[model samples]
Target: MAGDLGLWGIPVAIVGGAIRVSTPFLFVSLGEVLTERSGRINLGLEGTLVFGAMAGYGTAVLTGSAWAGVLVAALAGVVFGLVHGIICSLPKVNDIAVGIAMMLLGSGLAFYFGKPFIQPTAPDLPAIALGGWSDLPQVQAALNVNVLFLIGLALALVMAWMFRSTKVGLTLRVVGDSTDAARAMGLRPAVIRTLATAAGGAFAGVGGAYLSLYYPGSWNEAISSGQGLMAVALVIFARWNPVACFWAALLFGGAGALGPALQSVGVTKGYYLFYAAPYVLTLGVLIATSSTTRALSGAPGELSITK
Candidate 1:
């Protein structure tokens, strides 16, 4: 194992792990970016994620098709997003509080429905082969990448382009920056926010589906470990940029894989600490970048959380 590290195998392992594990984070962070760009926060994304996992796994198990699972999970995510949008739009209702409630509701629903999916086996998603050039077994293992990673990267680029160059993106930014200004321009802030939330939910749902149908092929209570929540922090760390979200998610994925990679290489001491690397990194970044003054400076003016 030490020899493997000496041979630069660790870097391959890290890259492979990042590609595999970052899919969920990428989805969640991108979703959060969309929501925040629309001047709202959906803390309940954790719930959307878990429920999407359950829905995806259950659908795949029943329908025998991974695509069916993805579609169903996306639909469920939209429902969760719509619910969040409606609740947050109510007069005097705190969006944060509603987010928390939605989280509880989503998690509870997932737990209730996920009981059947806790079994040892389920249909897994097919992987696209991209390591054909590697002759060494370890190299192949380390080079193998999931197709979803490619899709995620493409989505990031698409989103970045949309945000930077599209009329719809301009309207979204305007609404997020100032609801009053948007209203003055005949744009409905509520409608924009609702649509963004729903779209974000769909992305988050796909993230959950990837978890259940690809990286880990079984459903259980412990299937997700705050990936959804950390994704929210990641979006902030990325400054609400979808492209940055992609890199941030990959970084977080590498952090997450450190412990397992070490264990695979015959080092297991401080395993628990390694498992916490992603969260610790998240906290550190938050502390470094977040401040009342900076929030006021960089955040959309109409965003209540920044205020």
Candidate 2:
């Protein structure tokens, strides 16, 4: 017998892991969606993610309220986004370079502040029982989705509506499409980008908060594992659509859980390969979507990366 490879177990494990793993990606992807839609890219989201995790966990431990921790993390993310936006807006300072620098700064800041939270045990986010209908234990566990997961999905839908229907979303898209056009239309490109970056950072911060307060409590050097960076790649894979980011996040989450699921099944031979699935999938998506032959296509036209 190859263990209990029943009809219910594997799917339950995957669904559970996808719900858990998708939290961070959902936040990061959503944040990137906002920033990119405003005609800028924040590579420093990696730093924002780590620092947010540390800040959120530390705050929750101190205040005994996970919500308070989320607030503090969002604030920290705003500050990081402001710094990143301001630096990128300056003449001669490339967005890519600024993003890399912010990543280092964010990671370093997390390491500095995360020392005390390295211990086991901190306040965690509460989960909502959406699977009460299922009598099976596996079904219940799989359906014990976190409140943040629901929030993330809601945010995606709201953002999609905004991007397609709202004035602010229209302005963001216009700014991303052409800076000169924005300037002509009396829109402040710098202000729009700065604000968008801040909003994006806040989202990323929430993602970090989920990591520390929900999925995996406590903090350490390996707390993040490049989830933030992979999120940037995911935004591209999702074609900068928040709704698509949600689905992409779920896919990435499933890929992320493959190794652990295999281990649970008593298979560990290709563990490392499973770990690489998300990145491999991301690269494949990028190659499929991007084309050097067509100049300024697929990506936002005014985006620095494409130019």
Candidate 3:
């Protein structure tokens, strides 16, 4: 029975897929956590993600340096975040509305500019050969992890601690809780939120960099596939905790990888249906946590959605 279904390969493929697929989710969710923690939401991260992919790929193509591409992508995210932050800070401007607009704008710009680089080849990021000790090829393939994934894991731990122990984290929490309270503390809410939003964009950009320079490793318009928008829901599902976001991302990634894993083992029936698992999981998570009577547990007080 163990060998009948290509037993070991199934789990191995799923595990490998989870690690590969979750990097974008991890980065975007972390960025969203930061943005939402500052009492602002940048739904436009979808645009940022797409744009980052293009910029990162184009930079890598031009400079022959994947690292430079990641850096440029991050800068692009900062610019997008700054734009979203500034516009949303205006009186009576709806954050959601501006975010939608930004999404369109970002994607449009990326498509137009990225057209040139679509045919060009870019350097791919190198992976850590963690599976070299494994004698089995399946085990070796599954164990090969990327550096960005490790960095993401380290970031989650640092974020969890920062939220609990740092002055900057506390200040972010304070602003996220109440604008009036933040002002009373002599902190400028607008400035803080703008900066925070930009920082969040930077994270999203790196996530974009990972998508193009690693994983599927290419520049294309359709690369993001709503991961940025979904990260918003992911933030809520994570209860606004960074460490929770990490685990949640892997769960999402695993769900995403289910179809491919099954197909790799000759389970092709209903393959397309399996691809929907992540969306179904996202919907289920939203349904389970959503409440009309009160704010969600761990939600920031000043978030408009909770209000």
Candidate 4:
């Protein structure tokens, strides 16, 4: 297939890669949306993500079930999120600083504990063959979508709807907008934030599972490549909208896939530059969306970044 298409393969490969690459972003950004919507930011998700990858990979290697690995990873993420939320809820505690610490802690833990499993093979998630109608190998390969990506897509839609129509969503929004108001309404802002953060961690853990058990299909110290951190910017760019986050993730995924896609066609002169496309896009989106005079429209009112 690589030899079949000379120039046309780039776009095709990118589209396919976007679907594969976007799963992690989709899950992480969605999780961040939940956390940020509850008036908290979790920087430690990088650690949570890395740890999840290690846990999931290790679990799969031991259990021989990819699904089990995902479940365990989500549970691990919950623990991470719970710790971050609980610590940040204390008076005078800084969410950003704690988040940074969490990132380091998670990465350190993953590296230390993951050493043994680095060389072990784990069960990988199955893909849905959506391109059976196509004869071209490239098309077939590109269309072989993973179940996690589809689930993420559905989850995004469900979350968007949930935010609009559910009492749970209304409560989260109220808390995110104003803790004083939430307290007046007899809501426990701290408890809500902690739970939301934990739930977000579960989503992130699943994202990590996707990376290790499916797409890249391996456990490594550098598996994440900072996608966990980039998700924060992705959420901001989406204006905190779940559906928008889905699209934004795909855009990022496409940018990420560009370098490798180009290389597949023998365009390797600027390969590293191509790999930097996602970072460049992140910068561009942040700059284009930022304003010194006014808070970002649609941002949660109590979000620390806006304040």
Q: Quick one: best TM-score, which candidate?
A: 4
lDDT of candidate 1 vs native? Answer: 0.85
Separately for all candidates shown, the number of backbone clashes (residues 3 or more apart, or on different chains) is 0, 0, 0, 0
> Per-residue lDDT for 256 in model 3?
89
lDDT of 3: 0.89
TM-score for each of the candidates: 0.95, 0.95, 0.97, 0.98
Ten residues in a row with the worst lDDT in model 2? 1-10
lDDT of 2 at 281: 80
**Cα deviation of 102 in candidate 1 (Å)?**
1.0
Better of 3 and 4 by lDDT: 4
Error of 2 at 15 (Å): 1.3
Mark the regions of model 4 whose C-alpha exceeds 4 Å error after superposition: none
Q: Please write out the lDDT profile of model 3 over residues 81-126, one tens digit for every residue.
A: 9999999899999888998999899899999999999888899988
Per-residue lDDT tens digits for candidate 2, residues 1-307, read 1125564466677777888999899999999989998999899999999999999999998899999999999999999999899888888888888899999999999999799888846778999987789767667777788999999999999999999999999999999999999999999999999999999999999999999998877678788988888898898888888899999999999988877766665665976578888878877876776776775345788887687
Worst 10-residue stretch by lDDT in candidate 3? 1-10
The positional error of residue 269 in candidate 2, measured at the CA in angstroms, is 3.2
Off by over 4 Å in 2: 1-7, 295-298
When 1 and 3 are scored with TM-score, the better candidate is 3
Task: Report the poorest 10 consecutive residues by lDDT, candidate 1.
Answer: 1-10
Ten contiguous residues with the weakest lDDT in model 4: 1-10
The TM-score, computed over Cα atoms with residue i paired to residue i, of candidate 2 is 0.95
- Count backbone clashes in candidate 2: 0
